[model samples]
Target: MPKDKPLNAAARFQKTLDFSAADYYDQCRNRTYACCFSVENSPYIWENYANGSEKGKACIVFEFGKLRAMLNSALNPEGAILFYNGNSCRQIFEVNYGLVHYVPWGSHRTNEKHLSNPILYTYLKSDRFCEEHELRISLSAIGIGHFALKDGSLIEFPPTLQLGFDFRNAIASAAIREILLAPGADSSFLKTELSKLRIEPAPTSEKK
Candidate 1:
């Protein structure tokens, strides 16, 4: 008989950021929308997450149109957190209170982790801001296969935009984040002139 495939074991436990929900609640600080379980009673959630029971449950990154839906499901209006690393969410895409896909400010991640859900990040300073921004943004890009190494992963092949541009040398993913960050960014493509690169889209509309 053929050997059985290895089971996809649950993910390992991890510690959450060093801040209590009360600290954020008192001043409405560092609470972004659409990330984890709850900054409130976070210590309790942290304990559970550290025990490996919360692995597959947490959000990983954006999933197209789900961001807005999750926010509306939040139990508390102030439960929103700045960021989330899909690694930390207790439920995959467990958004609440109209907060689906809408990432809050000052949230953090040193590398790309928003592939599975998009609402994972660490709050900066645990100090939340009142006013947010116009339109949401994505920190990473959707790739052909599994995520690439942090160093120079996205590349152009015969780079060309169907919109009539070339970006043979542009860091496509990071550049998108930049364009979102700064207003009036040169929203142009085709970094390597007209005839130097190639870019193509998927031939089918099937979901992976």
Candidate 2:
């Protein structure tokens, strides 16, 4: 929504929408936060995410079911709500996880269903990235304003929001299956740090 950049370029499809649909898309973008993972152990992901740095990259493999369960239990408690903007904004905290749907970038036609359901639009991506086999976990809290105010005017909040989870405990339990180091990563350093957390680095070929 901010700019037609690589990560959010799919948002450009908003141009195809009328005012009402575009307004809904903007609302969804403001309230949703998403995290992406690959179903495969990809060298491309390692290289790009690490910004071509060789020695500091590592990936932790999670058991999908366990990870999802932990996240749902921790983040989405029953009956959570926030009162804002003269309304009771019920917390629609969803732990939705699934494979991403990729379409050709040149295909710009708007789907009727997607116009009605703007949140689903978040799962669409350019087919150029299909090789990543991406799985996304999106959390949304609708009807709440993510902003700050100073002196009776709106102030800019940080670009990213921090959502906390008990990951250390989850890792100690069954949420994490293994940790894989990149080709040139400092294995010894990582192993030592993981040791403090009682996690041992495992071979990349190891299966959950």
Q: Which prediction has the highest TM-score against the true structure?
A: 2
Cα RMSD, each candidate: 21.7, 7.2
Task: TM-score each candidate.
Answer: 0.16, 0.69
- What lDDT would candidate 1 get against the real structure? 0.26
The per-model lDDT (C-alpha) reads 0.26, 0.65
Worst 10 residues of 2 by lDDT: 1-10
Worst 10 residues of 1 by lDDT: 1-10
Q: Candidate 2: lDDT of 83?
A: 37
Q: Of the candidates shown, which would achieve the greatest lDDT relative to the real structure? A: 2
